[model samples]
Target: MASVAFEEIVETFDFLEDWEDRYRHVIEMGRAMEPLADAFKVPATKVDGCASQVWLMAEIDGTGPEAVYHFKGDSDAMIVRGLIAVLKALYDGRTVAEVLDTDAGAQMARLGLDEHLSSQRSNGLRAMVERVRSQAAGAAEGV
Candidate 1:
């Protein structure tokens, strides 16, 4: 899977004339996520701050110090699903150190995500970032 750039996301939205098309794009991205296995799905990993039910699982491999984030979510909100797709592309397959150092908030702002999103949606996005950051921090501490 290719990691989508902020510019690419903008171009994608621009290509679509209406919100319906944009929404379809978002849904398609969500559908692209790799499914979480039943054994990996745990309540403790669920992101509670989101209005929608969002589950995130992280696998850290010491071989190359790579971290993989697997996400599964269901929401009535289309934009939120798109936002999650963006995050999954960016953060998955990265190292804990890399994820901790990345300026995810700034990138999101540059994508105009906050401007286009409702307050609730924006909060949910931030919550996702916070959860990832927390996990990265724990891993860095060797917890």
Candidate 2:
């Protein structure tokens, strides 16, 4: 969780220098992710309104200041899973407040993802982030 570096992703994109290459890199990111267990694909973990099926689980480590939020997620579509990877890079293993503080839309724009992706993919990506924030909110409240 939060394992990928933003700078590394930026460098990879910049080096690829073509939309097709960048697109492949995104797909590879998803392919490289550790597989989510099938049990996590249950209805309770599903994120609503995505064109592709998506599931996410938020595990709060503890109740105190040291609490960390770990997220596990998956998507039926390759691109969507890559988008989930982006969200995980920004959010997972961080405290709930830290996850909430990230400006994900700005992050996407900075990555130039907004220009290359389809509207449906963009909306689905936003839905993933919204689900993460909502879960983080719940964890923060519980603490």
Candidate 3:
């Protein structure tokens, strides 16, 4: 996956004329996400704070010295799905240490997501990040 920076996404959003166009862009982004296998589709990884159903799946492979993480997520909300796609592209196939070390919240802020999102959406986004972070931490600990 190509890891586009948060700044790029923010710039793209800024360039859009209105929320409808933005929503279309977001849906397109979400459509780019690789499909998750049925085995990875579980309720436990589903985000609870979202107004729509959201599912996240993560796998940590530690056969080598470095741990690698693979993630997939789906959401009923177009923008939220796009946000998950962004997260997956950024963090997938990355080391657990890399994920744990990265300031994801700061990245999201840089993306201007908090300013653009409704309070409920922002909370849902926070929940998604927390879930990923917890998984990364657990991967690092070999859990």
Candidate 4:
């Protein structure tokens, strides 16, 4: 149930024979993202459980389960930033219900991230996913 953007990443990952190349591609994706404004980097948006500073500011359009989900994220670490970019592809522009329904762990597993990422990085990724889902759940409840 990955978005088209995320599917593209999966395809690219499949095409890249070397894990190192895939890793570089992820870093490139992070480099390509527009930096989150400093204004949105407040405590409210800061993601816990990350080794480096990270922020995720979600923007839900309309209300209820059908509301569209979007967010901007930034990280002090390049690899974490790349992981945020990956999360963006997975969830951005999707409806709140869709976001809620997504099996993020399974999707990320398709990229072999579970095997490749460090344990700390994996926990950070899970935290980011939780943050996104919590935001979507709030929107779904019209809160």
Candidate 5:
């Protein structure tokens, strides 16, 4: 199940039938995010496969499978930053097990992202999801 924060976004999306309105809402969400610090934007946090420069930094608390997952991300492109915001809603503050178990594609599909996003954006989104999952899995492994 998605977090209450994410459910709120889903409800907002449902109310905003126009994709353009939804798109603007996404950008606004991105704009609202606390900016990722310049110090954390190094090579290790940088994500591959995105057309734009993207970075994700994870902070895992606790240990093993029960570890809690949290992250901050940034992107050069406004839309991609928005995508990162969407991802944050989807994955942040969950246990590593929950993060690992989330069917991201299915969840994103609920927002009609699969239909509205460009192919490149879709691939970028997948890459971002992979990065989050990898971090969660690593936490689960006590890495």
Candidate 6:
């Protein structure tokens, strides 16, 4: 995960000349992802709106304003798993405030996700982002 920094991903995507290459890169990232544990795959964690089954877990690491975040996730689809990798790259190990401030949709857009993804996939991606955003907000509000 440390190797797959968000800025590095952006640069790598920029270097690739074709969507085919980009897709391969994405799939590779997904393949490299650490799988979510069976215990974490609960109904409450399952993401809505995804055409493929997906589970996302977001946890706070500290108290009050100092709280940090960690995320773990999985998806049945390779592309969606790769999309999760993209989210991980952007948000994992960040402070809750940092996670809340991050515009993951805009970040994905910079990678041309809107141009390349299907409508269903796009919606699913949004769902995943909202889930993470909600997690951060909930932590901030002490929910």
Model 1 lDDT, residue 45, Cα: 68
lDDT of 5 by residue, 71-120 (tens): 99999898889989999998899999999999999999999999999999
Top-lDDT structure, candidate number: 4
Per-residue alpha-carbon lDDT of candidate 1 for residues 12-102, written as tens digits (9 for 90 to 100): 7777877667667877877775555666446776777788766666666553335443335444455566677788766766777777777
User: What TM-score does prediction 2 earn?
Assistant: 0.90
Candidate 4 lDDT by residue in tens digits, 25-143: 99999999999999999999999998889999999999999999999999999989999999999999999999999999999999999999999999999999999999999999999
lDDT comparison, 2 vs 5, better candidate? 5
lDDT of 1 at 32: 70
Q: Rank the candidates by lDDT, best first.
A: 4, 5, 6, 2, 3, 1
Q: Model 6, which residues run further than 4 Å from truth?
A: 1-4
Comparison by lDDT, 3 against 6, better one = 6
Better of 4 and 5 by lDDT: 4
lDDT of each structure?
0.67, 0.81, 0.76, 0.96, 0.94, 0.88
Residue 116, candidate 6: alpha-carbon lDDT: 97
Compared with the true structure, what per-residue lDDT tens digits does model 2 show for residues 55-139?
9888889764346888888888998888887777777788887777778888777679999988888888888889888887777
Q: Could you estimate the TM-score for every candidate?
A: 0.74, 0.90, 0.80, 0.99, 0.98, 0.94
Provide the lDDT at 9 for model 1: 75
RMSD in Å for all candidates: 3.6, 2.3, 3.1, 0.5, 0.6, 2.4
Error of 1 at 116 (Å): 1.3
Model 4 score (lDDT): 0.96
Clashing pairs in 6: none
Q: Which ten residues in a row have the lowest lDDT in candidate 4?
A: 50-59
Two-way TM-score contest, 4 vs 6, winner: 4
